[model samples]
Target: MPLRVLSTLDAAKTQYYHFKAIIVAGMGIFTDAYDLFCIPPITRMLGHIYYKSNNSRIQPAAEAAMLVVALLGTVIGQLVFGWLGDHVGRRRVYGFSLMLMIAGSIGCGFSMGTTQARVLASLGFFRFLLGLGIGGDYPLSATIMSEFANKKKRGAFIAAVFSMQGIGILASSIVTMVVCRIFGRKDHSTNDADIAWRLILMLGVVPTALTYYWRMMMPETARYTALVELNVLQAARDMGRVLDVPLSQIAEVDLVPPSPPSYPLFSRKFFFLHGRDLLACSALWFLIDIVFYSSNLCQSHIFDIKDDGSAFDAAFKVAQFQAKVACYFTIPGYFAAVFLIDRVGRLRIQVVGFVLMAGLYFFCTYLYIKDSRGVPFVMYGMAFFFANCGPNTTTFIVPAELFPARFRSTCHGIAGAAGKLGAMIGAAGFFLISKGGDDPNRDEKKTGIEVILITLGGICVAGTAVTMLLTRETMGISLEDNEKEYEGESVQGKCFP
Candidate 1:
């Protein structure tokens, strides 16, 4: 076989454009998390306004739909945009997703009707549109950042981009808390409560709008240019411009392209080559998101709310509590992953994180069994901390690193879509499992929250085992090297060696 040639992108030193790419990509994630998590607080307030007779709470089905609908949109978006990113070019379709997000956010804010059902229908539809945009952002941002970063810092860079999710979550909580404080009245039936949710929804538009021009300004990734399109000169020029190096310097470098894959994405050869990788990436993401989205969107349900409090007061308290947890624990875990991912390696961190989270979950389950609220809450916070620090962050970074450049975004989207499916399951199932019956007010059975915690713990344990069996460490290795490694392994055996 001929030797693989490294392009300017594979060999180029990290530069200003790398960090710039992170910021541009990271901002999109910030908007995604902000928009998604903001709904939980609003849901509480919505219950009060729309269903005043039922203790100011909307039906459990409506609540689940509000969270799951976006995830459904996300799964669809990941598949569609992931394909489009590869079929067209990343930059060509990148800005369109942001525009969708802007439109969706505005639409969600304006959702109104004569009846609660119509209003919720409008809101769920708009949020689904918003989720489509957010889903598109996942593969695009991960692919863009991974392609831009040097191998030495690639894991950290991707992790940093995802870590913005922590910031987004924190921002959502903070915004909700502040909005509630300003607009919340003792009587949730008033117009002020209605305005607050709208304002919070609209707030997502600001960061997304700010990032649009910059996203448009970014050139197509050099890997996509040279390898996928076979436009070596253009790739070099774009790389030079982005790296702020002279075009002559890039031109002087040896930019031999690697041999293209011999089979199509769905062919038997392709499956043999990458099936294990796809499964590992998809399964891990699926498990992590089951807990991640469930915990995030169901915060009000998990925490103890005082029966004596008014609806507005309960909503404000929940928002405040969530903000504190995110700010203090969740956000910190993301940065911890950012700091350690490159140094410690992806698999190790993921394994350790899963193990830690499993332990925490089991402990929290025990606490729940004992009917102990305060300690379990702290343990839950700790679980979130380790999750972001470990698998939640690593699952995203690993898939972007593992795939071939041509199919990278598509594969990442598949994995991400799997995660969203899990999110949908978790979002819907959490309500069913936690409530222990169809009746929302049913007393907790032995199989209630305790069972949910135990299941999550089991998922973490299984995730840890799968990581050991299927995932390879990609730290300090160029994307090209990683691809070559897999290609070599495929040639040696029918499955990944």
Candidate 2:
């Protein structure tokens, strides 16, 4: 019928605006991708200068520190930025996080002697700052994008944005290979060491500024306007414009029920509604971070097939460094999501991903137990597949859809901080296990590498279990209801607490 045709047309046009808004919000996710992925190369560069030996505890510390510090910084960033975003506006916090990323990146590049206490202190401060920015991106981008996207498509859109972390991390690897080639690993002096890191740090500014550029070109979300600006008529007008609906369909009345402009994150009312959801979501994130960081932070180790003393030497050397950089997949993953996301649902993809990842981790665990390289590589490859499919990509998408605008960022921040705490646990977990068991170094009751992989495998399995029990299917639904469910109350329909 003509009516059906018209309805379809209207839906398509509305989607165009949703697409644009999702694109804008997803840019911040791109930064997260870069931060996680890029740090590896910088750490590798540190190996060339400071650690000089890839196997040194210092190298592991630097790599783990890269994630741990960033994770720690994110804890602060999430709490600070999330509160500000909800209080001020997502756009404002988005910009604020970008600035911090730029400053942190540049500061990291300028790090002084790891030998010097002052330099180490400086490194910690700025790396933490960068983490803060990276951390801030999750809630801001996910919430803003989810609000703008159609409910049917929100999960996919959120998944797409979060998937950018893989892309950003991958791109860092690419850049590392190129940059290291240009500035080979061995000038040997502290000055030379600092130079490469500085260059990498400076590059962080480019994305930081570029995010703002795109935001300025876009308008604040109609949803944000509806909720925060208290203008239903204007919100409707904006919505109508984006959806291409007749002005009449978007009546002059406010769409969201009227309520107080401000609310606290921890108010009893909010907690009762959202507490369980937050706990489950946060725990899930913690599990993901444990495996995600443990694997990615030790990317170089994944390629090692032999325990032969000479093989590790070959890998640890500057020559094989290119291979290490190749491990980054965040960049390519992010770009690919730009296309695949609009077409798929987040939960579906995530479930698929986790299933595949469970298999891969299990395989990796087996190989470690068997003392064979084949299964490790196989699992590594499978993880690459899973990165595209689910856990790595889709977990980040959930909070964006489930939380109401009022608590969206807050819930996201809490989840993210929890994940960062997981990252800290993961980062430390690897080094601790890698420490020679029984014998402080060299001799071991078990291979440190196997211990780490098995642990990650166990974590991945735990995620699979929790996700099945705690994860709700978020396929097609009215996005407006997500906000309405809370209808000015935190728990009205939330999965929290």
Candidate 3:
């Protein structure tokens, strides 16, 4: 029998807590974006302070280590924290990730060393810690939001949570610009701008720290308490407090589960039931991140703004350009996903995004092959728009909803880990391609960039095929219905109007 509390949660009107939940959960994402995207500028600052090179670019080896370490930590964090979320409870494990983020941010900012190698090692260590926290947030935040949201607007709520990413990126750029402007010296070679990078790195803690208290205060998701733990009374009480509803309405809920799964996670029965969905979510996420992170991480190099002034000035300009792109394309695409995800359906949106992204990648490839010197900001921006509105948002949302509450976080983490692995690949590949210098017109550099774009395009085509063939639409459907389908039971009715 379906629990009455679950029904009420799925049918509850938009409440104050819903918005509060979004803020608390969304801030984690905001911090995640800020920390991840803020690196380009910091690397520039590092090159200036430590590398002692005329061009002020860090060595290829140090740059790759710094860039890819967090990704590695994130992958491990996702798997570890994801399993913890299911085993220990979401609320129980959620605060720890935030704490790690706070520590990591501060540690990164305070990295101490007399030598360049030691400083790089210190920074890389802290960043890996930061990535762990950020990775944990992905599965926990998405799963919590999905469980709390009413079925009717679940897509919008989840998308809204992910949309904070755009805001975080904008914040990173703005903060970097402001810091560089204030601390930057007229002389391009001075160490005056050293503090600017530290400040930018540490400032990510504010949003993360702000949300930590509220994150702890959040009740364990009702689905986890009731469905996973089989504690209907606690679930009812938690939701009662959250939704501000009377306990009497849900305390009397039916306790019988209509054939809940008895299999362990990743067992044969579990795989048989959810294997295809897992494959789709993981594969699609992996594919999208390759395109997303590579382009995002290498934005400065791709734009190849001529060194018109001081190194500090160049850093500020890069920040401004990033902010402009975020404002024009990234932010809009995220909000568009928020508004249209439910209306258009996740499957169609993802498929369309992949197709469009493929076309744009091919076009960009052509432009690069033609040795176009001008920034293809229009094509690049359009790609960002579709990506945010399409796979990036949907990849996070679908994994949360498709699996049972028992394994939801674990599955989401696995998918997220897959995505991060792709990110590591993309970041590594593009950084290598651009490692030569800032000159986009360099013959060898142009060829490498064109090859990467073409590869991304081909991946998108594969993503489209995988998405269409394997994914399911969870729109306008209750979480319980997903469980019912897994149980091989006939769904009696839709829970949402």
Candidate 4:
């Protein structure tokens, strides 16, 4: 028997609760982006504070540890919390992730040691904890928003939540600008820079902690309640209040046991039915993040801030340049995806993003080889724009929608982990390659940053093929109907559990 509450939730018109859920859910993502992106500039400031007396930048190994440890934490968090969300309940596990984030942020801000190595080690450990929290937010927020939204506007709603990431990135730049301006001084000194980085890192908790109570207060998603928990009556009542529907409209007699059992996550039956979808989602996410995270390092190269001034001036300049990119390109790209995702369809947008990014990367390599100045910056900026407007947003949204609710969180978490894996590769690989290319004594073609960009371009081309082959169009379809369609396909192909 079909659960009427699940159907009502899928068909309900957009309402105030929808926007409220977006803000509540989106704030977690906003904090995620800020906490992740804010570190790069802060790391630069850290080098000035702790390593300046040595007459060198932060050691490459230490810097890489600082940059990548959070991504590692995110991967673990996505898998652990994602499984927990399914077994215990989404609402129950949600608060734990947020709490971890708060603790980690505070810990990083206060990270201390007598020696520079000890301090870096302490910071890395706390950031790993922070990453765990950020990772948990990924599947929980995306799946929650997806399950709660109406099918008609579901893509847009989820995209809107993901778009908060743009604001978070912007906020990172703004916060850096404000902090650097406050600490700006005429002479070279580590004291002010040390205070500024700690304050900046600690401030990430403000918006995140503010949303904690509201996140805890949200009702369990009706889809999860009825379809997963088998609590039809409670689902009906909760959604009734949220959607402003009269309880009488959903007949009490219609409350019944969920029928047509779906295959469990990772089972043989699920493999036959959803293996392709799962593979596509994971691969696309992985491929896109390779380019996306790699591009993040391009800011320093693209903007090319001269190191002639005080470290404070350089931090301020980096923040200003990043802010300009966020304002002009990155943030706009996110909202553009939000506005058009429901209309243009997820698969199409992703293919477009990959194709455009591949072309842009190739163009960037060409520009770099030509020794061109003043133009590669725009090329790199456009690459960022399309990544957000296309694959980055769509990859997050697709996994949440394409899987059955039983396996939704798990599958989304897996795909998200794959993306972060790609991010780790991108961050580490780009760093190594860029380091080699910048060596005054090295001239190998293989070690050049241009080669890395071209390799990324090639990866994007492969992503386009993989996306088209693996993923199905999910636009404008209810979650239940999507589940049913998969079952029908499996049956017609004579696949059985």
**Among all candidates shown, the one with the greatest lDDT:** 3
Off by over 4 Å in 3: 185-189, 253-261, 436-441, 485-487, 490-497
Off by over 4 Å in 2: 1-19, 51-59, 113-116, 185-193, 237-269, 302-348, 372-375, 436-446, 484-497
lDDT of 3 by residue, 415-441 (tens): 999999999999898867766345446
Candidate 4 lDDT over 383-418, as tens digits, reads 889998999999999989887777888889999999
TM-score of candidate 4 versus the correct structure, residues matched by position: 0.94
Residue 215 in candidate 2, Cα distance off native in Å: 1.6
lDDT of 4 at 200: 86
Task: Sort the candidates on TM-score, descending order.
Answer: 3, 4, 1, 2
Better of 3 and 4 by lDDT: 3
Better candidate by lDDT, 1 or 3: 3
* Lowest-sum lDDT 10-residue window in model 3: 488-497
Checking candidate 1 for backbone clashes, the offending pairs are 47-56
Q: Tens digit of lDDT per residue, candidate 2, span 352-461?
A: 66666777776776776677443444447557656555666556767665666667777888888888788889877876676412234543524676677667767777
Question: How far off is residue 66 in model 3, in Å?
Answer: 1.6
Tell me the TM-score of each prediction against the true structure. Answer: 0.93, 0.82, 0.95, 0.94
Error of 3 at 310 (Å): 3.4
Q: Estimate every model's Cα lDDT from 0 to 1.
A: 0.82, 0.61, 0.86, 0.81
Error of 1 at 202 (Å): 0.9
Location of the lowest summed lDDT over 10 successive residues in candidate 1: 488-497
Looking at candidate 4, the ten consecutive residues that score lowest on lDDT are: 488-497
